[model samples]
Target chain A: MIRRLLLQHQRLWLLTIAVLGALFGLLLLLGALQLYFDFRSVLTGRSDLSQAQYIVVNKEVSTMNTFLGQKGFSTTEIAELKAVKGIRDVGALTGCRFDVNVTMGGGAIEGVPGMYSDFFFEAAPEAFLDVQSDRWRWQEGDSVVPLIVPKDFLRLYNFVYAPSQGLPQVTEEMLMLVPFNIVIKSKNGNVLYKGRLAGFSERINSILAPKNFVDWSNENYGPAVTAANEVKFLPSRIILQCDDASSPELAEFMSEKGYQTNSENLKNSRLSSLLRVIMNVCVGIGGLIIVLALLIFLLYTQLLISRSSYELQTLIRIGYNPKMLTARYMRYYGLIYLGILIVVVAVLWIGKSLFAGFMDEKGFPVPDGVSMPVVLLGVGFMVLFLVVNFFTVWLGLRKLAMPR
Target chain B: MQLNFRNVLPIPLADTPLPPGSLWKSDTSFESQARCLVQAPSGTGKTTIISLLYGLRADYEGQLLFDNQDTRMFSVDQWTEIRKQKLAIVFQDLRLFPQLTALENIQLKNELTKTLNEGRIREMAEQLGIAHKLEAPCGKLSLGQQQRIAIIRALAQPFELILLDEPFSHLDEANIRKAAELIMQSCTANGAGLLLTSLGGNTHFDFTQHLTI
Candidate 1:
């Protein structure tokens, strides 16, 4: 019998309900997907974010040999830098150049000059987990690990060559160049022995190898160093990853220990803040849409009340007094509100599944830890707000029930 | 219509209006008993009396009785249950649900009463000459048709007594006769007591009882 009454007024309910469900579902799905991707990137070190800031390293090049003497950052200095309060890790960075002599075929092939710098392998584990955890998949027998570069690097250099003709594709292998050299030394001249190339990166021109290997090789080679322009030494670029990024403890610690440290926390903070703003906008818009949807729902329900006033009056005439009227109408309100909530949840689930497919197409793998809880929380909030709003409207209409 | 008032109590009417002497002992034994249609005059407390009968007017000194029990012993909840199970009423204006179809308007009352009587609804519609407009919106129906639909809805409920206030206001002379006949037939079939208020000048149905104030 109730079904017949609803059917009598189906059009309005259908339109209002469909709109409510869609807004709630889309909000849930987008929030879940973004949270999932964020966690994945944080864990995998694939988030295109720079962890540190840079400072000027004065290189007094009285001669080319003196230029080599001012080798970026030594491994020993980096270790001491890590112990500082705000200094999380330190690394050496340099520019790239062509090798003066390396031939692959009959053609006069040039050897790729690699940027030899100190990399703090242990201090910043997340930065290398992508290669370290999955080393076996790409490792090959070589003293140095080959370079892995992104597809974009192809634009910087020509990788085209005919293997049969004995011409190499690209000589700028970031990984392989360092693996060929083994022993690495600290700034105080302590040395660490290393093995052959553990692996080659999938990315082109992007070569990442163990830190000890590169430092040792550069220390031994005098009057010459590759990637001179991109050198980073005792500077503010090191982020300690501690509670406070900007603290006097870090600056004093690095300065007193003969290790130069610059305060790049401000720059890093600015960048992080920018990223946080974008994230907040995405999530907040989802919440805002839900609020707007609830507003529309309230309006629709009010219209429903006006349209059904006569029916309510009829109920009154059918021996239903104020109390009975409240009970009967509340039951109806509860059912319709619950139905809308259920539909919203189901739609959110389906939309998340569809969005998962889209994310897969984009090749970013999101973990369950990030997706499930966010989805549940989003759906829960929507349902909660909707119920509160529904009860408020129902209560208002209850006041209109006349005594019999 | 403009109603004139005379001897209608200024404050409120309680069981016998303070007996015109002592302000105490107002029907002390009959607490739960409420009077309906005891008197009718254009403005001589007719609306107030109806309001009191429906329990809408609370400021009254009276011993209303239910089953020989005093009304004071019963709670508001008890009164509501009595209203739902034993009493029903139609308003002065034909408050037909505008969004509902003619059939739905009737079924709403039945459903609320927990009595799903679909067959009776269809039968009543056909007899009222509104069978063709059973599926039409109440807003689109003629005022006379809406009046019949309201009457049908009031009669379909499972109540001991049904009240009507200006029930046939929208009906023409012929339609009014038709509505009166149908209401009389349904009331007798259900054995439900009817208390209808209207101008006796135009109506032709003879009543078993009438008390003009």
Candidate 2:
């Protein structure tokens, strides 16, 4: 009975427009959220390192540096690079300063022939190494040295070098069991050490040994320093841990310092950042639309209250409680908002399924249903809208119930 | 249950010369179950008195209290509780939702109070000679019919006080007698006080006290 009296003067056209506006706004908001979720999953699936959080940078090798034999970063340069914005930490790729020779193949854990070649080694901090293995450790007196070789080296040998040389290719498990000898030649003497492959790294490209072993061997057998107190050696390359490799500030800093890194990784990072900015803009527009829709809903409520002021006053005068009237209005609009949420969810589910199928056909597979975060966001907005509208109704009726 | 007027005068009538023996700007109190009739001519703030007592208008010089609680300090919820269970009113304008049927107008209040069943509501409509007009929209009904509908709406609630602001102004002698009888019967049954305002005409119910405003 109270609903009949209070709603008699409501303008249905205004309400219908408001509801439509709410629907559109919610669809846009949830749709953008769902798309962001799918896009992130696709990116992570394609390549984990494509996020470009870790990058390797080096000085640009020019003719002047080559002529001067000065292709390494000094301590002051490393310190400056570490202080650059977006660069979290810097670890130098310390190269072997002593002459080294690796000999393998004849009875080296069942290889077919004898082979000997000069090899180079670089050492970086364990934190930057991607390969996790117990053997990738060494103490000063340990006779055997654990090494991490680049995975691309295995691919290169298997795909190009082995077939061309008429040699058999080996798997990673088989190579891990092989042991070779390393001969370190120094001004003091020649030292022989056993070398064993620990694991392969997909992130770093160098043949890596434990940092302590490299430092120990360099101190014992490396060439004498020009000065007694000069202990630091310049690194030719440095691997950086950065907050966002895509940030233009880092790029500008690198360029200003004449540093170079993998251009492909930077490109991918920039692409990801661009996508995020676009998504944020879309979400912002959706939020603005929702605000405008809420404003329209409030205006409609005010108009209804003023138009039905007489009837409301009559209801109050006849002993109808204002709270009861407000509750009736809340229930009515709550159901409408619930209906809007259901419609938005259904539409988003269908739209996402179709879009996911399209993406799958293009070799990018996203989740086939509406994401959980999107549903939660939609319901959260609905609840917010209901609360705002509820307050409007309550305030309007209270004014009518007790005019000041 | 008690009405206390402490030197209450409508803001608009503050500068005017009130008649002698008038209730305005005086400290007066009416105890529970007292039947009081206020007789006054036009433009004498009769409607203002009823509006003030019913928690509609607060533009007065002094305070109006309901059972020793100042009406000016009442919250919305408190006023609603008072209207639903403590006080009821039939406005002078006959503020009915004209789009609703006369039966719906009464049921609106009955639904909130739940003090009367549908059969009781129909019985009261029959007593007031409005049973035939119960199904008709209040907008199409005559002024007397709408007034009777408003009265039924007021009686459909439980109350300690019922304020009737010129309730029978448009009714004939026969209908007025019937309305007054039904109203007095409801008041006696509930042990509620009645404050009926009139424009100096024939009095229908036996009043325990009379005052001019």
Candidate 3:
């Protein structure tokens, strides 16, 4: 009956649908923003250190440091880096006090007792490390250590060391499966342990280990390093998570402190927050538009009921309850709102498909299936729309059906 | 099944279709099995009396009791149930939906009452001069045809009393006789009363009572 009645007013309904479509599209955009951020955050965690906003910042080697062998970044330098603005977090590197070597099966490399290559370790706090493969952690008594080598070292071995020594260069995958005995040596004693490859680092050009294992080993085999007011025991490099690499304030601060960053082209991960602000503005505007649209719809509904009040009053007089009258019109409007919801979902899916490649390039990929969060958000908005309009329609009917 | 009007005087109401006149200034009892008439000149509150009894107007001054219960205390649901199962009315303006077909207008009442099927409605329309006019929109029908449709619709429900205000004004004597016969038969079958109002002496039924408002 509502369909038959509304057919005469198709223009009115079409206008309503236009406004509703705009609202649905805005809500879908908000949902898409949520999906983009979540996917990007996940990808950032899974990818290399290249996407990390943090940089391994250190001071340049001066004449005093080269001549005096004072290569460590002092505690004062670490404090100054912490005080720098636009930096969210800071963690200094803890270095090993002993030389390290690795061999296969806890045995000698190439059947020699001491033919293993030279390597040392540095430990950054786990929060700063981008790659968190299960092989990256260590326990005190654990027989196996984890190796996060430098991609530069791998390339050098493949192109230079392999050709010079006539030894076959191995892939990262093969090297990962081969367990090597890690021997940590000091003037007091030498400790032998097994080690497995964790992953390669893209930014820092040093072998990295867990911070706990590094501190314990440094205490047991090397000179005791104080945490404050010391230069030799201090970190060699300070990593600061930058909000914006090109931010002039950060650039000025770095220049004033004579700090240089080895990780050039720092990923401006704070773009997420900026984009969130933009999306929130859009959502706020969308919310206001929705409110305005609802008011228009309410006024339109009142006009329609006013125009049809005679027939409605006649129906009410014919024993039709107010609930029946209200429900009949509500169901009609509910179906229209439901139609808007469907269109929103369809368009959002299409939008995701159209921008999948772009999002993937930005480290956030649109999934193939329907985005559940977007759909849920659309549903939420649809329900709110219906709930708000349901009252307007009911009030109109009550006004017309009841004695004024 | 009983309506009591006690010192009821019509008061002005906004958007009220009722005329400005009192129903009665004294107690009057209308029963389910009783037939009554309200005789008055045009615009003398004939429809106003019916509208007040129909619960369409509430601005009248005094008490109306349905089976000794005050009508004012009746909830909207109670009034709805009473209208659904007891009271039926044929408005003077013939308040049929203009967009609906004659058959659809009758079917709207039939849906509420569950008293008449399509076959019975078609039979009733055939008995009148309107079986051929049933499929046409009510707006397209002549006023006389719409009147017969309205009378058939009023009889389509189970009722304690059916109010017909100036129902046969548009119909000729022959069509009035036919519509009256149908209304009388339905009222008898349902064991209900009929309260009909008219401007002049045009009714043919053996009315049980008469009143001048």
Top of the candidates by TM-score? 2
Residue A349, candidate 1: C-alpha displacement in angstroms: 7.8
Computed on alpha carbons, the lDDT of every model, listed in order, comes to 0.50, 0.84, 0.75
State residue A337's C-alpha deviation in candidate 2, in Å. Answer: 4.0
**Candidate of highest DockQ:** 2
Poorly placed runs, candidate 2 (over 4 Å) = A22-52, A69-105, A112-129, A134-146, A165-170, A180-198, A209-236, A240-257, A269-291, A319-324, A338-349, A364-388
Q: Residue by residue across A1-404, what tens digits does model 1's lDDT show?
A: 44343234435655566466545645554554555345435433343333432332222334773655454455565676566555444443432221211112132224533434443221112343234433322222334333333344443344443355454465434433333233333344444333333343332123444444334344443224456544432322232344334334544454455444333543244444555566667666766776666666666666665665655544543445555444555566556555655665566556657765676678855432234455566557656755764575456545454333
Badly placed stretches (over 4 Å) of model 3 are: A6-107, A111-119, A124-156, A159-165, A172-206, A218-299, A321-388, B2-10, B13-31, B39-46, B60-80, B172-177, B200-213
Model 3 interface root-mean-square deviation: 1.8
**Cα lDDT of model 1 by residue, B44-109, tens digit:** 454554455455554444444445454445545565665666656666666666766888777666
Worst lDDT window (10 residues) for model 1 chain A?
A: A96-105
- Candidate ordering by lDDT (highest first): 2, 3, 1
Task: Indicate the DockQ of the complex predicted as candidate 2.
Answer: 0.60
Better of 1 and 3 by DockQ: 3
In candidate 1, residue A116 scores what lDDT? 41
True contacts kept of each: 0.44, 0.81, 0.56
TM-score of candidate 1 relative to the true fold: 0.48
By DockQ, the better pick of 2 and 3 is: 2
CAPRI docking class of candidate 3:
acceptable
Q: Give the C-alpha miss distance for residue A236 in model 3, angstroms.
A: 7.0
